[model samples]
Target: MSVLRLVLGDQLSDDLSALKDLNPDVDTVLMAEVRDEATYVRHHQQKLALVFAAMRNHAERLKGRGVNVRYVRIDDADNSGSITGELARALDDGAHEAVVMTECGEWRLAEHLAAFAEGAGLPVEIREDRRFISSHDRFRRWASGKSQLRMEFFYREMRRETGILMDGDQPEGGRWNYDAENRKKLAKGVTPPDRLLIPPNAVAREAMGDVERLFGDHFGSLDGFGWATTAEEAEASLKHFLKDVLPSFGDWQDAMAEGQPWMWHGLISTSINLGLLDPLDVCKRAEAVYRAGKAPLNAVEGFIRQILGWREFVRGIYWLKAPEYRARNFLDADRKLPWFYWSGETDMACVADVVKTTRDNAYAHHIQRLMVTGNLALLLGVHPDQVDDWYMCVYADAYEWVEMPNTRGMALFADGGIVGSKPYAASGAYIDRMSDYCGACRYDVKSKSGDAACPFNRLYWGFLERNRGRLRDNVRLAMPYRTLEKFGEAKRKALAAEAEACRTLLGAAPME
Candidate 1:
């Protein structure tokens, strides 16, 4: 009897530890392109294409290694288009046990796997995913007895664990984080380093065409589809980033420009999430670059912190609070996400540009995610479901485990102060300071009221007013709450009215 081991689209590496002891003659690898996975939330057409193409490439690679791979394509006649259905069919083909690497994201999928395996009357073992340096249990141990989980503390612990950028017992440059030195607005008259854009190969070109035909009605465009769909190409993209853009990555990591969507960003999140590149290796390589004087300490540390700290922290939070975590709506927001998130049609130039870039390429740097789309949604009181779905649908790197915490907790503030101490909700002034898109916009960035005021500014004050009781006790929000206190009743009412008018005017326009 042979063992049937399930491998998801994201679990693509040949180095997967779960495959170590497997007897090739007696082990079968099951990889599938299920319609349910693709259409679960009406994902962007490009996102669907990227995952499917990557899965096909990975399956072929495994088969080339003499692994028995039961690959199921979406167009296959007998395809069940569901993980359980596919797993059951595979099990019926004389498999005694199932082995799998733990899923990367989503409690829903994990629960489904557990239930399905139990019903199959077969032993199922989910081995630890060794791709990440930090384990869920290690994070839990570190978080124990701590009232608040901060990324900085968790990051330092990971540095000590991995010995990355450590100079014996002390950290390199004698500092833990150099974030303050990293935030400089883009200098004028300087051309950005050329980004590494992978021209789609044969597989991607075919997948792109298929996606356009099958998912024509899906939100977002496929004009700028240049992502690497194979491990070799993903590695090339990583090397290019480490060589060219990494030297300036820290300084401009937060900066946004008018037409530039990929700033100092490596644009490797999708590849990393899909198991094409190991996060530990990426961090190690960046640290090596810093030691060689090819990249600055600030740039290396900032980038590593994202992978070691934020990325690991969010995964822990997802596993710890999931199933229930997705339903949290601290603000009780119910407004539908405006349609602009899909259509990229908006009067606000910043919003339009960000959405347009996201539509064209399922890529937006952290600032664009946090300050532009996410901040506006939070200020306008959009429902967490709408915001989360929009985020999950639009980004290629999105998986429920990572995307949920980022969208609901970090971005939307729907989880209150769990993931963030204070709401990231901000007015248009923040956009003005961060990006060049504000100057060309018709809305007044500084205005807090009236029709000509930016909708973000108007809705920001209204959001604070509406959520005063919910957020007033938060020490971080005290300053904003105090400002709200000074406004007289009539003034407060006027601001709310103006915000309401903007909401009415832009109803469904923000989520297009």
Candidate 2:
């Protein structure tokens, strides 16, 4: 029987479940660059280029392996512009007897694919994606009866299961976490290594051209598109990270310089999310580096934790509480995301630098995401939906499963502490300490009020006051709450008013 096998842009792995055990002679691999996905959340131009180029490259690989392949480009004259529309049109030709596909990445696409399966007329088999280390069933079983889920605890379990960096039954170096050591600011004149760039190949250049012509209104620039478009390129990038950058990764992982965006981060997230690089392989190699004494235990452990801990943990949590999780507004924040987010037209040096980096490279390391843009959005009382949308829109590595939890749970505290122990809200002092953006800023980081004062200073206290009823009793927040209480009722009210004024001036607060 001839079966039509569908491959989504993100499912480019050679060993994808749907492609396993296929009779290439009878099975035709189907891949398409559909319009709905590219424009779904106004995905960044680099993100669009990366996925489309990768998809095109993977299709050629399959064809080279003697597989019959049918590939559709975004600008094809007969394109139907949607996944289901393309699938239905393919089935209407009666060339194939059945349909097969691996599961999709996002909730919206999953629902759409499920609906297509229900009515596709032919028998359809949607197989599990085994690219990730923790399967959906594995994560669900791990989280079955927990009152509250935490990534640290879940990460330990993953360590035990994988035997990664485990010294017998205990963690390597007698500690499971090296996050404390990872927070040191970059000392003056200490520079990060230049990032490895994969110059756009012919296939990638075609995709980039298509993105510019079609998605001209997208959020980011395509000027320096350098993302790996195939598994081999991704592996090469990973190798460079381990050799040149991993040694100092733990020491300056959280540090941010004015023009430095990479800062010792492993820039393989786009590769992993796109299935060009396997997550477990990335973790195992880092562990091997620690065992070989090439990289410090602190650096290797921190790097592994991101993949084996937070990355897997967030994916599990996303499936556990999604659809409902996205609707949460525990703080009732109602401000719109400001225009400066798009234009980078604000005096806040940290935000402007990060936004510029995002537009240019379609990437900013985690600290830039969480501490800079994400922190400011939470303080300005931007609604969770707006915050989530912006994060999803701008980054090359963003897919719903990873982006939503980080935005609502870690960044905005909109999910009310499900994905994090406490909101990552902070004042300008934190930025002043970790980065040099404060030194060049027009506003004073130490001041607590007035126009020339840093906006984060006033808004930090306001976030606490606005959410007091919900957060006052939490153990993690006791210190901040006590500090707010010491300010007296009058001082607290004044802080709230100043915060409101800052939000209004920043255009975060909606005009009535």
Highest-scoring model, lDDT: 2
Clashes of each: 15, 0
What are the lDDT scores of the predictions, listed in order?
A: 0.85, 0.92
TM-scores for the candidates: 0.97, 0.99
Candidate 1 on 1-512: residue-level lDDT in tens?
46677888888877886676767888888888888888888888778889888988888888888999999988789999898899888877565565554554677777888887677776777777877777878978988888888778888999998999999879899999999988878889866888878887888887888788878788777777888899999999999999999999999988899998888998999998999998999999999999999999999999999998899889888887777888999998878898887888789899899898888898888999999999988877789999999999999898998899999999987877668888888888778887788789889887767878888988987888788789889898889888888997887787777777888877833333
386-454 in candidate 2: lDDT tens per residue?
899999999999999999998998998888889998989999999999999999999999998999999
- TM-score of model 1 (CA atoms): 0.97
RMSD of candidate 1 to true structure, Å: 1.9
List the lowest-lDDT window of 10 residues for candidate 2: 503-512
lDDT of 2: 0.92
